[model samples]
Target: MKRQPKGTRIRLLLAAFAAATPVAYGFFWSEVRGRGTPDGSSIEVRVPEGATSLEVAGVLAAEGFIFRPRVFDAYVRLKGQGRQLKAGRYEIPRGASYSYLLKVLQTGSVVTTPLTIPEGLRVPQVAERLAAYVGDSTATVLAWLTDPKRIGELGVPGPTIEGYLFPETYRFAEGVGIPVIVRAMVGRYKAFWGTEERARAAALGLDEREIVTLASIVEKEVRWGEERPVVAGVYWNRLERDMLLQADPTVQYALGEPRARLLYRGIDSVADHPYNTYTQPGLPPGPIASPGAASLHAALHPADHDYIFFVARNDGSHEFSRTLREHNNARNRIRLARESAER
Candidate 1:
């Protein structure tokens, strides 16, 4: 080939450079804008409070959600969203583009698992439900519940936070620590337990813990709204008369396992157990389960009545009586009705 003039060669090189520059820029832009990974499944990413953009990028990269932390950091800065990154657990969809992820982080679109802690669930039951959503195991949650330091920190008055873990619907981030979850639950209890309730408890010659203990019993005993205060009144009547509570649920609690139906023999056998009200002179040492707001209120404000006994009517309701003879007659009637139905 014939050698070209120096100026012409220089001009040709410049043209080539200009052509290649656009291609390079396009490739870079596409790389930055494209999905970070090939996997199309969802992923969870946790950004701790006060985490810098670089740290967040590193976490994403480590979790296989992103291919390049350095590129992610640069892109975040370029978008002026570095300071907007929020701390939470996010469910990043599979094949999500970098821009989409950035927006999710900036907008605090975290993945929250809804947890419904129903009224009257024991600590173990609560822990099992919690373990299904959070990172902790059931055993870990149980330990946290009984941990003296944790309970003390939360200012719960009992040996464990059994009755104080307010039962309600809560939204928790995936992989949330046990302490944070416990604190949130206890906080909810404190919020619902207002000053007026405390004053009412004091006026009734009971402390907060005693009130919760009685409320837990009421929650387990009755399911109907109108029956709570009536049942609470019956228990109060027994207490005032220095009579044994003789509650069947207390026997079940003492056995550490709930029975579908407690026979007379079973109740007799467990009567001596500390939690059994049939033999115990007073209330159980602590609450058997978490009480709902209505049950708590009922314990604080029991209805004034002369009734001292009740029995389930097998239809989500109860029959009450003011005397032992009437209670026995009602029990006989229920037994006859049950026998007739079975026949």
Candidate 2:
């Protein structure tokens, strides 16, 4: 038997270690960090544009989608794929290993689902849209929005979450929770209301929530930004004069059901509901809809006008009048215009 030199044996062992390192990494990555699952099931993980490597790792780890972020980092750094990880959205498997996650990101397998939440939707309507977007039940969203405890948990200083949910288009991955979506919208609303609006609302003897309530009525009443101030003025005038606002939106809210059209008889008959401005003689108990910035500003600083009645013209504008006679005339003209347009 020939004895190998000590130096030669050491060199051979070093070479073997070098060769085994990558294989060990691959196997460990599969077992602990998620390399490959036999089922090939995929999941979606968003790495948002402009996220740092650390941020990407933290998000994945926090979401429990990845078991070993360091392994992912190391592999990406070695492969020079760290810089190749594009932002936007990605679909990853539930038990995806770190290596698989890195590969998915490097290959730009991000998925983005467009979420369009229209303007002027109430909580229930918005919830319905959200559920449809995530393929969840609308009731799930309502359960969160309507939960007073949930509102408190969000740190919103309000009794309800009605006026705080800002309406806008969102890009959400599939299977997001209702609370997460609501929190995102509420956070946007908080940012919007954080500036001069809060102070202004306080000075006007209105709380932030009350201002939102009034803004909501203005939102439903006025279609044009320029008209919002005037519409707000009319409601303020009614509040000052001790006259019933008799806003259609308030009556609609009182009805507790959504309808495309409202009848005079319905307004006259809907009784004892707090949101009926015609009966309550002031702003409704809460917001009628989630108002935008323009409506909110208009509510805070209404135009100086005594005009009490506004009828929607055939065009997307309103006919403002100071007296019942004038209001009736405008209404008649609107009716005539509608008749003409139908013909």
Measured against the true structure, the TM-scores of the candidates, in listed sequence, are 0.75, 0.70
Cα lDDT of model 1 by residue, 157-273, tens digit:
686788999999988766677778878989988887788988898898988888898999999999788999999999999999999998887788888899999988887887678
- RMSD of candidates 1 onward, in order: 9.6, 10.0
Q: What 10-residue stretch in candidate 2 is worst by lDDT?
A: 29-38
Top candidate on TM-score is 1
> lDDT of candidate 1 vs native?
0.85
Cα lDDT of model 2 by residue, 1-343, tens digit: 9987756764565467558797764564464555334466765567777776667876787767756667556555555566778776676767776566777777766575767665577878888887887777878767867877976788765657777778777766555667777778888788887668777888778888788888999998887779999999998898888898888888887787877778877887786788877777677777888888788889999999889889887777999999999999999988987999899
lDDT score, residue 273, model 2? Answer: 80
> How high is the CA lDDT of each candidate model?
0.85, 0.76
